[model samples]
Target: MGLWDDLKMQYRMGGITQRLIFWNIGVFLVSLIFYEFRLGTFIFPDWLALSSDPLVLAIHPWTLLTYAFLHSGFLHLLFNMLVLNYAGMLFLTFFKEKQLVGLYILSAIFSGIIFCGAYFLMGRVSIIVGASAAIMAILVAATTYSPHMPIRLLLIGRVQLWHMTAVILIIDLMQLMIENTGGHISHLAGAFFGFTYIKLLQTGTDLSKIVTGTVDGVLRMFKPSQPKPFKKVHRNYNTQPRSTTASKTAVKDKKQQQIDEILDKISRSGYDSLTQQEKDFLFNAGK
Candidate 1:
């Protein structure tokens, strides 16, 4: 399959990360068309974009989550989606697919609530849109889980994930008073969630469990029930065929399992700690 077909298959397979990326992009394109026609950011209805005003939100509470999907401009949308895709992949290195989706949703709502509280405290009203808070949450949460993991960068050769997380978070803190107070407030809130989520997880509490159960419940509701047909219980292990397809699938599954184990090792220690054989496996897999 081509790149497009592969993406379609991924979407159909319901990978949470890819689905979020596609949803953001889809929303961005529609917003862009409306933006051109409506003359400005007003293209997005107030109902879809969150407001710092408590009164406005009281009337349209759903904006807390929906606002995250709308972006102010193309560059804003592009940067957010890029970061989300990168951080999200890194996040999945040690976490389940459901956790990422839950983090994004919970972070957005947390950020919105923080933004509203700040507005109320400061007696200000403003509009807010973007996925920065949720993206920040994913980036920070992944770093917290694998703080020592070394990530290669373009200009900066290699840096620990914790180092990057600290710098970005400090920047967000320092910018809180500069402008866009609500946005900065939201960012901080999301960061707090990310940090605490990891801390709580270390204590044996998985905050995403509730969200995961909800997702499973929804899926079960949609899944068609299988009928129970008559079955013969006679065992005949020697009569089973050794199919090539089944063997190939088993080989593929083994390779994937090996890859996952190597990734988990790298997450616990730095990439440099990887064995030569492990490094070669990653190298070949990348190819």
Candidate 2:
């Protein structure tokens, strides 16, 4: 009904990818407003932007993550967000929302660490900004998960996943010698995380679980505790409904069987072959 109400609804229903984009854009706009009002750039960005100096990073460890949501310029923000939207949609097609969040955060952190290391070696202190590292992770993660998947590139027609990755790698590699060497290195670091994330997953290990658990633990700390309701002092002898272990086993077996069947279908006909209901079932099971 209203702007705030519409935003709440969108946040409630929108996928994690869209929410991440919104957050980045919101921060970028706020930064711009502050700049426009002669607030000067030194105040906000200096606190949040990732720095190559180990001393600065040690003092403000949170900058490793905060920098991913900041941008130095409008074009910088636009390019990164565009890539994020594109890659995020592709990544979400086959992975859970939690996985996306984990990969993004982890990759950005890895990138920041590597960037800091590079600059430290060069004996220089440079503040890094932008979401390029995180966006690279999303793009590479999707490409790793489904290397054969087709994507339409302008003037290039339909191209395979590896092709896109190769081109990106080449561009990043080339740019390393030209300018922003740390940024290019960070992109490569993020790409490494994306590739490894899928490889480890294929071996039945999920890094997302760790990220999810940590998030839940922190959320619990901030969440207000609800008061307990009054309970009856007297006990009744009425029997409760019986839920047999056998029935529970049967239910679990059925769900697993369905999941197996859906996965088999995907392997044979690709992810697009599944019906809407089947897709939702698989997605929920992932959660």
Candidate 3:
């Protein structure tokens, strides 16, 4: 297949991680068209970037999440996308794709709020843009869930997940007071949110649901209403006998029972435990 065709295929088949990366890269490219390259840096407008001033944020509230999709430079976009791909994939292995998306969005907003609050308290004004906060949240959330999971690194061999997470957190901590303090603060805020997310999840509280539910509600509000298909009522003189209808009902009940058994098995031991015959049956039933 051609390059564009291949990318479309991948997008159709791949999970949320791939889609998120696509969105970040797509935004970066679109931003380039309007970006003014001054002093070898891409300067985004205040409407797009998250500003520390409460008034600016109040006026441009969307920046809390929009800023996460933006980057100040090519290298900034490249590194964040790389980390997002890695961390998002790891997160998916343990959680649903919806949860991963919800976490990414919620974390970015949480971090942005913290960034603004910190800056406001210090009586300083600044603007920030990048997906580092969201990406860091994904990485740390995955690490929190499976800290003992082994990961192999080039030249460094296999290490536990927490080890990798700690290194990143330590680096952020070390840089907290030095350069780019606001960015580092946002990163740490995202990390904190990630850690909290996993903990609350363990206690049977899914924080991601808030974001997921809000988005779903908003979509429902804006989605066009579909007209119901008109059905004409007809009296059939040649109706099936009662015995035949009862037999069909029995057969349908039997099929539903089998489906329930397969679903229960999947919930207990996962879909991989199902036999090929059972898999085919389920797939056909779904269709």
Candidate 4:
């Protein structure tokens, strides 16, 4: 296969957040290539980029959404992508694909709003760019989902998930007293949305639903669906499946045996001794 095809295949295998990282990186590279060709000015149109100018923003309100995908430098993109990768994987472990997508778009929009609002309040006339705010949102969401999960830091032994979250929040809070106070404020806003979103989800209410509905509406507008004809099915014979008491007892006995074996292993080696596969199996069995 050609190089482009190979890259596309690899991207297809990546998770939702990974796909987003690829898109952002692709945009950056394309911009660089255009710059080399002396066409960099067209990379991300000024109209599309977020601006603090009231006149420009009023003319193009969509900048709030587009700005989240534009990064200023390589290191900036790298940091954001790293955070996104880590948090997105954790989110995927519990959320369905649809929910993951919804969360991402909602997080991005919320982050954009925070960034723009902070910029205006800080009296800065510069445009806001980068995925940091959205990345922060994902990190906060993951922390909220499993606060007790273990996380190993370099040169710092394993720490509880909440501890890492506390450290991050503290750092962001501290940054508010520095030159990039606006960015820090945006991060805080994203983090708040993340935490609140997860809490609401647990209680069966998702704010992301509004974003999801909007996306569905747009998709349907582009690709209208046609109703399909339905056919009825008729069953020929009525027969009851037979149940054997001996077979039922045997099945129950086998399950009990498996449970006993797992309990014995846990008793002898401790829960941490079990592999992830084993732990998952035990968890599912208990469920």
Give the whole-model CA lDDT for all candidates, comma-separated. 0.83, 0.83, 0.89, 0.73
Highest-scoring model, lDDT:
3
lDDT comparing candidate 4 with the true structure: 0.73
TM-score of every model versus the real structure: 0.74, 0.74, 0.79, 0.71
Report the C-alpha lDDT of model 2 over 1-287, residue by residue, as the tens digit: 34564455445445687799889989877766544223333234456888887777889999999889888776777888888978998998898999999988888898999999888888888888888998898898889889899989999999998898889999999999699888899999999988888999999998878789899999999999999999869877756445675687889999999999987886567555767678667666765
Q: Tens digit of lDDT per residue, candidate 1, span 71-133?
A: 887777888988988899889989988888888988899999998888888888888999999
Residue 6 deviation, candidate 1, in Å?
A: 5.1
Measured with C-alpha atoms, the lDDT of residue 202 in candidate 1 is: 90
**Which stretches of model 1 miss by more than 4 angstroms?**
1-7, 10-15, 32-43, 221-287
Query: Candidate 4 — which residues are off by over 4 angstroms?
Result: 32-45, 224-287
- lDDT value, candidate 1, whole model: 0.83
Report lDDT (Cα) of residue 18, candidate 3: 78
lDDT of 4 by residue, 178-250 (tens): 7667577767887888898899999999877787888888999999678897988988673544467568788
lDDT at 24, model 4: 82
Better of 1 and 4 by TM-score: 1
Which regions of candidate 3 deviate over 4 angstroms? 224-287
Q: What's the distance in Å from true for residue 38, model 4? A: 15
Q: Global lDDT for candidate 2?
A: 0.83
lDDT of 3 by residue, 105-136 (tens): 99999999999999999999999999999989
lDDT of 4 at 284: 56
Minimum summed lDDT over a 10-residue window in model 1 is located at 33-42
